[model samples]
Target: MYQKIIKESNENKIFQYLFKSKENFVINDIANALNMSFPTVKRVVDILVKKNIIVERDKIGEGVGRKARVYGFNPDFCYSIGIRITSHSFQFILINGYCEIKKEKLYNIELDTSSIVDSLEECINNFIATLNVDEKKHLIGVGIATRGIVNNEKNFVEFSNTDSFPLRSLESIRKKLGVPVLIENESNLAVISESILGLGQKLNHFVCLTLSDSISCSTFQKEQHDSFSFKAGRIHHMNINPDGNLCECGSKGCLGSYISDKALILEFKKFFPEINDFDEIFSEKYLETNFGKLLINNYIKHLAIGIRNLLFFSNPEKLIITGKICKYKNIIKPELLKAIYTPNHIFYRGEDTILFSKFNEQTGILGAAIFPIVDSLF
Candidate 1:
């Protein structure tokens, strides 16, 4: 059993190295890079080749010794389903071994948050049923990225930004779907997605701040991440103001209460009773008014406060801002950075200190999709 574990570990390292570099490597080079024995590397390479996860693509160092066979990752060996559950939709993506999206579906039906477990199962099973027979056979697992404190080991969510409270066991969904299932906080998943697929690539330390229905923060360091830590990365309730508005978490002056979409909408409804929905705040007719100016200004002010606190604590290599609010990044950038800026850090170089994703709407699902691929490897 110990030997098997070591072999699997070596296989994982070699595979990840090849996959990340997107380069062809021979057994000797892989062994040398990974500090594994040549025999072990050869064994793992053979297994991966047999499993159709990698292939001999070319020859290298033709004159140095004998021509060494080079191998590269095979993207289509298997695929996984990734889902992000929002209040109104089940966002889905099918990603191949290479983490390239193959198919995407947005189930627009409203979720019955009171029965999220049943709704989730129905959405997943129904999505899987739409796949072709070949695709179904190649499906490896399902990954869920949710906006909440998720205990993946226990497969239950502690709390969600949506009305989902005390989520039921996901093991039931796994059994019914008849496939492996992994769940992660959408914030962490978004950071992971950025690390693997976006501007955060090759970065060991960074923070992802997502401003959606509520605010969320996820940090990545060189150290191992414990996805089930429960309390890890839960910064939405931090007290940034002592005399500010109240939050649903029963706290006054919570950071999330200042800039979350729901917060903005609630505040807007005070002046215009019929006003609801964060999207409506962007209408040109409304945004050109004095109320819009005040709201946007307040959002930038509080956003800076939250960001300053985050940077002071984590001091990450970069700060990635993603979510629906990012659509207005340009409008907010000037004021937002000014409030968070200092001579030494935060935004010393202005916009360079912050990175924004081009694919705002899909960040959560993309990260969720990559979770299954990461789970399969490690």
Candidate 2:
């Protein structure tokens, strides 16, 4: 009975206390902060250290009797693999306990599920081969963040109309890999990491919207316990304009239909056939061109509408714009600001805090790499 009680307590206490800590802490500090007895906290810390779950670092004190040891999650005790599979490429990253990427590699692979799995497996195996034999013992599990509908509980890709629908499960690949695997929507994972570890760390509520070739939103909520978590935001197929061109997602005026970089590229091609790339058209000289201003205006207007929808629903403390869209932030900021200044929202009275996603191009990969550690730690 005593053992049963201790085991149950361990589960609830350890995670609860760690979740409450902003960062690493000494035993005494944790005890004092949580108002728990020193001996109890010390005992728990010792047990955790012995289990290789938490780490101890010695700290020197100027006026103390004995230097206290600070404890942190034993980042090196385990390893996690995160892969971001996108429509255009796949990026694999190996992260240790401290959320540091020990190794990272990227490859361009076909978007087909089977081909992606094959390429990813090759990369993982190659990475493992390169690791020193001793380090292999620390590998824990793998996490994958991908574009499209993911059945989180089932660890499967439900569908990705970007390529096909009714997609087959990723379970077969996971089984061959022979480790616990987690598959999540790429945008959801991005928000989760950004909220817990990235710039959103300080905000209680926020929306992280990825404006790549696709537009998706995710929301972060602060729990009563003070831990911040994220959930995927709404994804609608509505068009940006009733008269606008149809989207691949079968939407008439969806944000992706007009504001996405792909959308802009297509528009530029139609208006300026001589332009070969979006990057070229967005060059410095183009900024002075009437065409550039027109592109920026329409892009900002569509984005503003989409962001407005998100704000109306989540009432986020901040809204983060990420992906290729961030590159044109200087162009879009003024227009986005103008739209937000006008009152369409009724629930919140003040201005919404707007932020550019600092993670930028690394958001998907970094967030995916940190997923396993975040999962285990929290």
lDDT of each: 0.75, 0.68
> How many clashes show up per model?
0, 6
Write candidate 2's Cα lDDT for 247-316 as tens digits: 7867576667877667878877777777766567667676567887787677777777887777777777
Top-lDDT structure, candidate number = 1
RMSD of 2: 4.9
Instruction: Pick out the ten consecutive residues of candidate 1 with the lowest summed lDDT.
Output: 1-10
Model 2: which ten-residue window has the lowest total lDDT? 1-10
lDDT of 1 by residue, 1-378 (tens): 000111246677777677666667778888888888999999989999998888888787746697878888888777889998776778888988777888888888666666777777887888888788767888888888777777545545765544444434677887876778877778877876787778787676788888777678887664443222112376778898888889888879999898888888887777666777777887776678888788878888988889888877877788898888777777788888777885565343344667777668577778787766666665
Candidate 2 Cα deviation (angstroms), residue 182: 1.0
TM-score of each: 0.80, 0.82
Q: Residue 360 in model 1: shift from native, Å?
A: 1.9
